[model samples]
Target: MTAVGAAAEIDTYMLAMPSPDSPVVLPQWISRGNTHPNSRYQDPIWSMAPLIDNPGTGLVKLHWKNCPGPLLDQVKLAAWTMINGQLRPTYLQTRGVQARSRSGGTDMLATCHEWMRLARWLHERQITSLAACAETEWRAYANERLSQVSRDTAAIICVRLANLWAFDQLSARPSGIARPPWEAEGVDDFLPAVGTAGGGENATEPLDPRVLGPLLIWAIRFIDDFADDILAAWAERRRMVAVAAAAKAAPAGWAALEEWLLPMARAGHPLPANSGKSEIQVATTYIAALTGSNRGQVSRFVKQYGLAEIAAERPGPCPLRVPVTGRINGEPWREHVDFNEAAELMKHLGTAATIILLYLTGMRPQEVQGLRSGCCPDPAPTADGTDGRRLIHSHHYKNVTDDDGNHISAGEVRQVPWVAITPVVHAIRVLERMVPEGELLLSTAHHEFHSRHGHAGALKKHTLTLRIESFVNWVNREAGVQGLSDQTIPEDPQGAIGLGRFRRSLAWHIARRPGGLIALAIQYGHMRTVLDARTSSSYGARGRGGIHAILDVETALAAADTAARLRDRVAAGENVSGPAARRALTAAAHTPRFEGRIVPRTFARKASTFLARDGIVLYDNPDAFLICAFKHDNALCEPEPGATAPRQYDCRPGCGNTVRTDTHAHQLRERADELDQFAAHAPGPVSKRLHANASRLRETADTHDATAHSAEALT
Candidate 1:
């Protein structure tokens, strides 16, 4: 056919094409219809094409046709053939044939790009089709790929090429073409083993307690004491707006009277338009002066009639000018409200509340962000029936997937226990007031720059991330100005704090805080209880999914760190405390010094299998005031079935499982001194009791001291 005739024919074929939303079979490629008949078929992975500069024009353009034209056309044809089940029986039986189910345009695009790269490599070696490439060429390509990108990336590239080669071989055999030598070869042989990418796991460090401490303390004070100021300010602004609207809608000459009277009202000047001198009295005097009316008439107009008009014409809600004054990181600071500041304060309040809930409840970031109005409407008594401990009902969205691997819209609501912290509950109530009725607590309003775009409902992960970063920056800046550098959350060396790190950090702190020294110093006694409950019971219940996985990893790391510390102490000849001191010392002696191996260190730290063979495992229990050298059923610390660790809160003082460090010995000394001081000041029975407690503390301290001296002498 002539060129013009072929062009006309192609145009007619395009015009006769099915709708993009409809599935239709392409001629010469497939006989069957699309697998996903209800959904539109797309050539996946095409959008990832890189833009390249046109060497002739120096202009950048998307290199859509960069792949070999004939090969590209053949791939497109193969895609249709695979989708419609027109492939050979051999191809149909292959495990990789399932790639056909990934019919999206992006998926096809990625496959096409990989095929194009292989085709280019073959062409460079003077080979034509994939069937012409030998094992040597494939090896060369694999080597080139490994040198260019990550092992995972190279593996993906090889896998895609292998799939395409398999398809090409299946197609060629039917057409009487010879198979390529590389066709039967496995890409797996050339590719490195790939595991799940860590992706910021190492980089996501927790917020420092030094910073979080003051930040939360300020947040509590802000929510408890200063949050009401926002409401009052809002009401005042609304009232002013209502008065202004009423004045505008007043009688024909009232606008002129208002214009004349407002200046005098603001200036505290006695209006010549009215009679009285005082500000309140001058308002009636101002009306009389302006309208040429008597004082009695003006008084009645101001009180009974005009005042009712202003009250009736109430305006819609207006932005509030909240008064903010606080000492961030121990430095006093003050801020006046304007439009931006008011919006910012509102956002800060929301973020503060979010931080408190996440930090205190140990809830995942998504779980906290997913919190809607009336989530925790009523706080009930905790499982233990503790007076101050309460349980909050909230939803968790992670792992809420349907049978088809799609996430359900609404999350599963679970009752979180021991949330009886008053400040946290108070923060929740404050958040309730900040948002409109039935709206999300951490809504788009918390995004100050984006609030004007209307209520976007629940906070997105990225939005919360940005807000947290901004919140941290604001706290740091405010604290810096107040010379409270010590109180400021320091910039992490790994990276800024992210939402995922909170739960892990809490677990780490609980498992590793030495003798509850830092925990007690930080005033997190209640938190220690919560952490213990979560680590012991909740960890196993959740089955190592989502946040539970992070907690498990951190817990293992904490255990390893504790073991390492114990080893160092033993090496330094420092005496071990507790009933299991001898066993703990033996285990410490066996712990191999970790040089530069992370995987082995992680294994040694987390897994008790090796330690179990020797009848010992170092268990961290900071709240128990000593580490536990647990020996399964023989543990002096009662071991709960199906629980990997002992309950620190239920720790027996003389339990053979316990192993105290030097810090514990120091604490005993301090306690002895404290008791002695109390006994000296007490009278009669109290004095006798105090003296007895002091003597016990002194004896324990002396025992630890003597052990330490003996170990030193032996060394």
Candidate 2:
């Protein structure tokens, strides 16, 4: 029937039939109770809460009440159809648009928003239905929308509108255009510039070094150093609460108060003062909780005995005596953690563990949230009698599909587990102590410290985001007290810290580091060979989220930056000499300028090609005081056969690829001078060895001065 004919009998045709007449039917793949479909399409709201297994996916309700009155039924019909995979053949026939399966909860919500936008636009123009709207009106809406949002975002809205044309026969209002939004042109025209058929570059910015370095330093410290104090304090808090609850049930009165105070008095231990304050103040409520007396009764007893004045004379009480093991600059980070702050500290500790996991494991935030207490078990032995590394098992939701390529709400277990490093394992162990085994490590239920307070479920992303910011603020606040002001994580120019940025930043660091695994080996205690052999390539390929693409972008950028720096140093009259110095100069001069440009996947492909040029690939090693013009054949650092990059961390002396500049000579002599100063303070035989090493360094400097020639003269 035509849309106009459908509108006449809309109530009879569109409204859901009685439950007995039309029993609830679900898609075969949708494991019955995983999603709830509203029987009546006339309902103001349709909740897909069960469909959202991951809280990180955000909201899942479609608010039909929010749409304009004229197109409400049309919007509902389109959304319902999309969720049920009921798209008409006409919509599937549209060029460059193909969606065969049911929409996921998150995608359904986005489609609803698109419908609302189109509905409001139509209503504002006094157009009641899609049948009356023409190509002219659609173009006007698209142009106005393109100005407000990005071309890609605008394209999504355009695609949604085009789908309506296919659903015209089903919708009572028939709100859609007959032709595509951009006539004779495809939706691909609005996408970001790319050279290949691959996806767009990752837009998530890696955390700036100024922010990431200190952030990680403090996060590791929280896991390694402060964890003991925090966990102990938490246990003490729980113990105290339990004792208080027992006393409340069986009121022991003033006799209990005397019994509690007498022991501390005999030991000459000060009363547990109000830990919330900076100065000592007898905690009457704390005393009452311990003694089972009212606060007034405890206050009366303290006044009669002059306990407040006596407490002033004695050192402040350390109720738990949880020693301050975490230090800064060779001293304890804090003298003591107070009982009042323990609950707050536990929350921050969870945030710290989260940061360590996200930054080190390269797991997405939701995957980290999905992690249970026993996610990482002890390392097992392989069949070959070798020790296997620890692995974390978790579920990934985004882009998770079944064998038929249809999106499924019930996320599957990752076939290849994430390899866990020491820091990640430490963080997991710390979290395991906080939450019960088999419970989510970051579950909101465990965060409250008290069983009655929080809702039981995965902690939401916005909540985690706030916790991250609070953790940063806590670090900065403690910096002054610890006298480590330089170690404070500065405010990111990219705005507040987030969990999403860690993966991108990790990929950047791993790909940009001198050796692919050198940074991981030092910071996380995992060898490069193990990660590469086990899961490195598959980790990037599994999701196809452009992690490998991101790595290539960073690698290319690093290479380009190194080449640019080399070119600048040569032009500034620095002398350069080595086996491949001339080749280095030539490549540096011709290297493409990529600074400040949006690096597309095409650039990534070109970057792979750029890195493949072996004999001339320049790897700057500041620690070694030289540049490596890496050649697979001549490399003494023992790169695997056919490897394009050099093992820069294992730079061997006398390698033909090593290039020494005027700066390297200066640094060598400077090092020799420092060693001479150390030699003067050493014992007899030790002093002689120091002097010999210093002399050797000076000789190397002299050799460089003799052989090095200016870049202008060499070319």
Candidate 3:
């Protein structure tokens, strides 16, 4: 802890922590290939009953399976917790969750694989720990990767790089700028793209190694996170199914009830990492229900069960069962052995319902998990034109803005009107058929999964990824399909899919498919840019005087068409912009002005940046350029899910809009020549500042036309 003066100290610290004999162990290699404990517990076929429906009666069983930690997983979880001690609650509903606070007697220190990697990064950069910073506190917009987490999560991979470089804890930092330490190449990744025409030195100053330690830990954490993402995805779905089955089950005796509740809730149990407290509570409540008790009387019985040791300390196979009456719509929602394949989905009604809800509403898992029985529309405000359609309202929302663009308080309602999709409808139908009979659309006996970290029905950020992963796996297994890609990115360096992919996929479909939401929503305020027009924004934005609706029907169609083509182009190794070249140019020529100019449209350039921004584009493709490559000379956005290498794209004069000229023309692909004239021909003061930090940029079509073009070349 004393400024990490030597390598031996790290060994000393590890030794001081959990001994090898401890039940909790951090192994030598932190890679995904590392071995973990396989669960030894297996329920008799008869014990395999649903837990939620009969919480008060059925037995509570668990098999503690080996759970691996991913670097990013640790970062996200740790970063949030580190920022304000905000551990989420377990959703037992019978009571709220509270953590024992301490001054400093027991503090935790977590970092990436080695202290040196972190030390180098931290020692070289000047980053103010967002753990204690604020949005308004930023006086200048520096370009360091600045993230403030609500949970104690951090990306150990990127963040750790900064911690080991420099240790200037007390030096003044540039406003808004931040940095991770230099990489193995001995170069910092998050700096202003230098010498580009318009780039600036985004780093305010170099950070001391000690000050940058937090970042190194955060980045490596992400690396580890992605590595373990696949396994975690599988475990998550299994957990959800169990928890859901438990929520509606009948309560059991005190012994069973105590087994269900104590781990995540009562004093002796430490909340399991990754698993939310709410989900656990939901499972326990249902487990108790199966044990033969009701929610009201379950608490005392649980305490007794705790005294008796009925609650298994680990996780594993159990008989997930339900009473005959527990059948959802006269069919077992969890087990339907009597039903044929067609009737089986009647069992997966929950999974399908969840997937549908998430995709349609675009709400994070936390929002859905926090949904309550009464969290419906007021019917007071005249239902907007979108009334009959399924709407998403975030009631009791925290850390998010409402539909009206208002910030919501913790436990406040925030609703988002969702465009219903076929899947969403399917999910609703399933939910209608499987409604718990006693609570909200999504409910639990104690609402444990929903309240994973802290409260009666608490939800956390990871809940989204966890639930989505579960749904996706079920979809893959149940659909009996392979090679199907939704919006998710690939998880394996060689694999091809993930969760965030859904949103992007949705956007891609909407942007590329003429019939998708962004296109259709235009008539109803899902706007797009029209060069020089008063209505230049999309979806909706408040302008100088009026709340202008900038969405359009034609442009939507064009963009959607282009988005679909982009997929083929991506597959064919072409830039996303190349596929939509003429269309983007046309749209660019007609910039619409709502309250102000909509964003500058960089079709090919955007594709390059996006590819670089996300690892979807092959690293070796010379054309791949960070979207901000032109925006900032030095900064490289983090790659998207599924990417492993950190190489640039295949370069071409017209590949994308930006590239790094500092190293070589081929260092990155650029779409510079394709940028709209407004930017390409922008006054020197503007254009100069834009790419100056970058070493150079490709010549625009106009420049080519003026210099070397025949009339045909000009065209």
Candidate 4:
């Protein structure tokens, strides 16, 4: 055919009607709420906004504008094959295929981009048509992509390319890349599988301990102490906004403005100032809040009364008299929280609450973001009449499969709700106050619900991540004011904090901190043993799958780290004293170093088996100033029948499983001295209790000094 004739034929083919048997009719909207389809089959851009439910999925339009004009028809046709598979399954029979699951709007956008890449490469070489591209050239393109990206990405690229041949019958202009590469085998033959685990492994790096400690400390401070002030500020701001908005229609006169200013005058307070310019100017927004006046009324009142001069004479911060209840280092963290400062502080409060929920509950960021108001209702009393644990009710999209093992696009509500720790419950309560009932917990529309975009879904993951870092920066900047210079969160060596890292970090800490440090327990506001038991019970749940695997891996890895530390202490000529000291030495000599390396699911299984081996299970108990060489039979801490691990939290004074090194003895003595210092300044009864605890710690250290023997001699 002539070039002009071929071009005319291609344009005719591009505008061809959808299959007669297709589910959707012509010029129909593909997505929900899309009354009008943005494009016909031949349009360069396909709007996918209506096809997607969540804006966070990204890229609501597919731009075929970048493809060479000649190849555009072919690329659009290939996309239709996939789109037909997703949206019109009956049409696929024309291509000699059964109903096949295909990409949704987001994935379709990606697939379209993949096709454009091939088109760009072909256009670069001055190849105008798909049919003109040979099999060799196709293989070269696929191979080039495979080398540049991950196996998973390579697989996606190859599959999209293969589909051109696989569904050639559906297209008018078939490609000369006629057959699927690798003959009898497929892309899997050459490319390795992406992930090794059937049950997913957590690859997200946990926050460094230096970062986790102070970050959590500040998060708790915000929730526990700062919440009242922040929430109050928010309520006050809302009232002021409502009043001002109403006042826009019904303006306040000078008489009413004078009445509003009477209280400030009686209290001998200056007018609230605006720092918009370099000068101390009267703030119209504050005036509007005080007098139920609009901005125009406030402006007129300020000029008439010469309040700008008064504001300049008495310029400082807002004097709204909101109490500063939150304290740090036994002193008030702030003297006052002003309206403008409070407005800024509320966002940080939200971020801090997010940190508390994500870092403690082991909930994925999406799950936390998905939470709606009243998702975690107040706990009802148990059947046994004890206080029931709070549970978070939400839907999880990841790995939600149908009865036939096919993934569910819209996730179902989790059958088992996650047990909410106290901090998590508090965080939820605080979030509940931010948004209306039944709204998403972290909705971006919290402050601007009446805007054009109503209830703009949950804050995006990247936005939350930035807010978390901002919270850190804000804390660092204000640490000096709060007398927390030493407690400022250190920079994480792992780089920027991410939402995914919080769940993994929670697993790492819970698995490692088995000793039930008072700080850890208090941070959670629950018994450590109960937390361990309840959280583990939820392992293998339908919604939450990998957390159990993560916990097991972390436990084994923490043991390995503990053993390595023990070996170093022993090699440095430290003496060991305990009935299990020999077993500790043996385990230290044999246990492989983990060093926080990535472990596959198979390694997680092996880690479970390693933990089951009784007497050598070394648990580093930093809070107790000892190591626990756990053996179920010899344990002083009560163990359930057939249990493989000891309850480190319930350690008995004379437990045979206890091991004490010189380092542990030193820590014990140090703790005793610190207790003595505090006791010297404590009240009479409190001083007696502190002194007694110090005596006990000292006695334990003295006992270690007298009975400790060289680890080398024992071996």
Candidate 5:
């Protein structure tokens, strides 16, 4: 046979392997023989062919694996080519080479896998080339794929196929080959609906404060009062185990001088045949059953065994406890944690620290997990001489991408102001002590059994997720036992609290709460600024951006709430103060009521557009109403936007933006009464000034009363 014919035959062969001297080399992470057991890529057929790239010529090749005979022949005949002194397929050059060279092997491999699925589908239908495929055929293929997999997976397949067909039209067709029937249509037209190919809305709801608050209090108490004892006990247990092991392997006379220590060898002796087990053995068995560990193992050990004994002998009262009436298999049980169980305790502490950092600082979960031993540094004094709050220096990994859309290994370091709360700071200190310096704070040390990749010292996202759920359950149980049912963390019927929700929750609370709660006020300003800057930059102004998206949603809810309240007052003939208040009331009359907490999408869009006019934002203050026409330069509250939201706490009575509701009128009347009392007892000059202030307050109150009376008469 001729050389060209032989080469053509070799390319068409389904099982033909690449030559040993081929330029392409599979990526380091890709498995060679059968795929690695832990690999996410589980497709046995796809796993056979590794992703191969040649750096020398900037080319990558993906050989089909376990491909049917007809599919292999069609791909070889249709789009295979040699480019840049390397043999590759045209599709690979169009998609795989760029992905491999500029991004990473995973991306390139993913594209290759998609192409393989498309090829297999076409071959199954007995189609030879792209020219035979059309919209109807594409839809049929998509439906078949969807039946076997998820909508997302089917969408991906359709997208990849569409891209390949487009590439075939542009680059693969030879002299006699006809163009594909759908060549004129863009790839998107033949693809699934845009959002159908992605995961559903992420659970971004934050942990309920009722749940978070008690957990934080318990965690702080654990760190400050009990953590050291737990650590020391675990260490002592380790030392005892080491000593016992050494005594077993002693050089003959190691324990000769210590007669008391020698009896420990007999401690493991089985209970006598007719004798009932001791109270300690029964307790050990009960704890084993509760914790789901081994009963024999728990009873045989000494230093780490007899959890009840450890609890009884501990220096202070044990922080962990079971109910006095707790029962296991109808036997009375008391809660006691063994020294060896300190590992699980430490895990809980780690989770607490993670929660404190994530929730308090409004840091992303990734940012909290990325924290190393030295992440939280002592607060430096500000220019005015007061010591500032602590600052957390950690890496922000999300949304960091290189020019080619590849994730940069070490993300940008962001310094966030730590919440001034003592619990938050104490939690950071405790986490630092848990692991050695330079290691991640939320390491996998506590729950090593759950980790599969020997990431015992590196926390995983799923691990944190599970820990948070467990922490909530534990906190709730403890609260119930202590008769603090009100403190129990409320269960979210929607879903468990997730890592991403912390920052968004912070933003939502800051934006929606009336005058903002004090606990939030102390930290919200700095958090909102950082989040707004990050999210606004990442996702443009109009898009539902990250944390900013939550803020926007909350803002809409707040506005709708404000409108509803104003409408209720207007309907009941209550007065509203200021010209803007009147205008807002008029607007509210026409606006529809929000049925639930969630503002409808159409209403939200309209509200956003409406609220944007005149930089208007409503602030629900207790003493006075505020409709901030936020003109930064003209603001009377402050020279510039500062940490505290100006409209909420710094509203100036004389500012053009200030407004008042009936609640404000009540506050004014109370102030007037106090001033009148002071004026009656003061000397002449003081009394005159006090009287003038009192008069003004009364006049404002009367004005509100008269407005309400007029509205009532009109109604």
Candidate 6:
């Protein structure tokens, strides 16, 4: 049925859409039990408590606030036409277009907005509908649709509807609805952009200063109704997919311009003979502009981010014919790291987004090279019983208003929820304050991303090799050479941690929680079934491996047991391992007495499939995993007296096999990273000490290696 056909579902959302201008009276208690369908939303202190025990009807205060502008209003209206009015119609049109255009039945019809994002978009426009046809569902808008005026017409309808809605919300225009009785007296022209996409109803698009402004915003609001996601994904994984990331994403600037020019040369691309006047020489500059920033911002970001001049200019490491430098743990290996090489360890943090992605998600270098400004939300969605806008929605990945302010881009944007420890919330808030509306939310652009989808560009296309092996070597080079061999720079475990691990690992963590990924992962996947339908790929051939790696089940089990003994010892008034004097034992070596306990990566995958930037799954060597103690897994890494020391339990000695030292400590010298994922939630001081110890442990290991080197030289 057409969306117009499913009128009832539309009212399921819109009866509460609040055209109410003044206070409307209602009974003290709601008539029907109200179960807000969105599990993502948490009840705020000031908000109505959703009576979920029984679903029902209840009237909510309808004070409107934070409305959009005239043009924005028009755009909102247009958006409504397409999203609500033409929901089924557009799907039919788009479906026919897809079928007729190519027999291939391409996957391009998928919405750029994920389930929750689309839901949020709909809710904000006051077009809240529970109808399947009204959902931000798939409609193929290909080149065929692009050629058709209806496609643009649909987009135009979307923007107009959204603009008007935002304006009404801001009180710039009159609200079409009535107000509720319970609202306080001072609330006039009440407009709230609550639960809006981009976390607000402002609807500002990031555009380079060199370009036109307001009209551009209009173009964005009008044209970008739902096409950005499709376009961005197409750009990222398009004809470009076959190309390796190293080539597409290389930091190539001037030095390798000669070779990079070959692609254009092959196509006889345009370039002025004079590099200065020529766009080719300034391709990076253009990339910044087209991507909604000034040339300077893009140039500075690319340079500071240490991008290669061209793919070929990217640095490469010379693999050893032999272990020229030394060995780690008596194995044939590379250079040694000095752990006590320093006293009190200090770590300088980068921009919070970078640091968080580095510290929390464990994303890698090139993968993060092109963080499209603010694609990662400032405050992730929080579950502390508040409106869910604080949650980080994932649509930022597909399109973020490119240079012309009329284009799109794609990739996996962060979908992190805000049910985190306080510091993470603060860090998120800090980011919100710092970001400019049209600017990239990231500290610096790692490379020039001219496409609609920013980072989806392969690194190798710009010129270096793109394999994970190459990525490993590049990071290893810094650790092994400039930093390791010279000893000037201390070892950073985060260096070895790359993009491949985060989604799977996070999935594993989520899987172990009570309600499984649903309860643990927080926020949502639009609806229940969307998350549950992953068996095809998740446990399927290409996907199961990722679930295996997400959690180190072996580690968790071992860790759990260690905690129990420690607990029993405390209860019995006995010291663990016959503790005599002071403090409880460190839990770094908690051993789960039960063999069956495991971290639930499979369930995590089922829950967090939306998070995987690419469908590709990550796998870990089965031998590499072990059970974990909750505290030890989260942090509080130390040895339990009755349990084996983390060091003692190693493949040999001093190991947890994490990229960290304790995680990194026993394996301080290894390149695999074990950066702090738990620090965000830790009691501040203890977390600091733990990070310090990890850094220091690496330094000490470095020192010990240095001494051994000196001894060998004396011999």
Computed on alpha carbons, the lDDT of every model, listed in order, comes to: 0.52, 0.69, 0.30, 0.70, 0.50, 0.28
* Model 6: residues with Cα > 4 Å off, grouped in runs: 1-359, 362-372, 375-446, 449-483, 486-498, 503-715
Ranking by lDDT: 4, 2, 1, 5, 3, 6
Give the number of the best model, judged by TM-score: 2
Model 2 weakest 10-residue run by lDDT = 16-25
Model 5 stretches with alpha carbons more than 4 Å out: 1-136, 143-233, 249-337, 409-424, 445-453, 514-521, 525-553, 568-574, 578-580, 586-615, 622-639, 642-715
User: What global local distance difference test value does model 1 have?
Assistant: 0.52
Model 3 has a clash total of 260
Where is model 3 more than 4 Å wrong at Cα?
1-347, 378-390, 395-497, 516-715
Cα error, residue 612 of model 2, in Å, equals 3.6
lDDT by residue (1-715, candidate 5, tens digit) is: 7554555466542212233232233233233441322212212222212332111111123455645565554443222221101223443455432332122333345545665676677777787665566667766765565566544565455544544543333322222233333334533454445444243222245456555556556665566665665555555544444444333323233233123222432354232111124432233332332333343444444344343343333322222332233232354322454533555666676777777676666566666766678876887789999986565666665445455444333455653333335566788788777777887776665335323454323466676789888877877776677666766777664567777767656655666543444244534544445443433222112243334445555665666576677667766666666645644555556545666343333443464464454434454555343454344455575532322234344556666555566766877878878888998999999999998987888787777666543333333
lDDT of 4 by residue, 470-557 (tens): 8999999888666678779888888898888887787677666654332465443243344334344452244224465566677778
CA displacement after TM-score superposition, residue 434 of candidate 2 (Å): 2.3
TM-score of 1: 0.60
lDDT of 3: 0.30
Looking at model 6, report the run of 10 residues with the lowest lDDT sum.
340-349
Q: What digit string (tens of lDDT, one per residue) describes model 3 on residues 1-715?
A: 5443343264331122212232221332112432324211121111111111111112222211211222222222222222112111221121222111201101112222323222223334443243222332221221233232211122332333233221112111212223322323233333333322221111111122221222222222222222123223323444544544444434335445556555544656432222233322223333433455454455454455453233335322223221222322244323321211222223233433554454334444445555544333333444564434333344333233334332222334432233343344434433433335434455433224232332222223344345444544554453233232332222333122233333323322222232222222331112112111233221111231111111122123233333333333333443322322333333323333222112222232343234332212221122233211221122143222232212122123433333221222323214443333445777888876555523344433223223331212222
* TM-score of candidate 2 against the unseen true structure: 0.82
Candidate 5 CA-lDDT value: 0.50
Model 1 lDDT tens row, 138-176: 667777765666455665666566656544433312211
In model 5, pairs of residues that clash are: 211-489
Span of 10 residues, lowest total lDDT, candidate 5? 51-60
Instruction: At residue 624, give the lDDT of candidate 4.
Output: 83
TM-score of 5: 0.62
Clashes of each: 16, 1, 260, 2, 1, 147
In order, what is each prediction's RMSD in angstroms? 12.1, 5.6, 23.4, 6.2, 10.7, 24.7
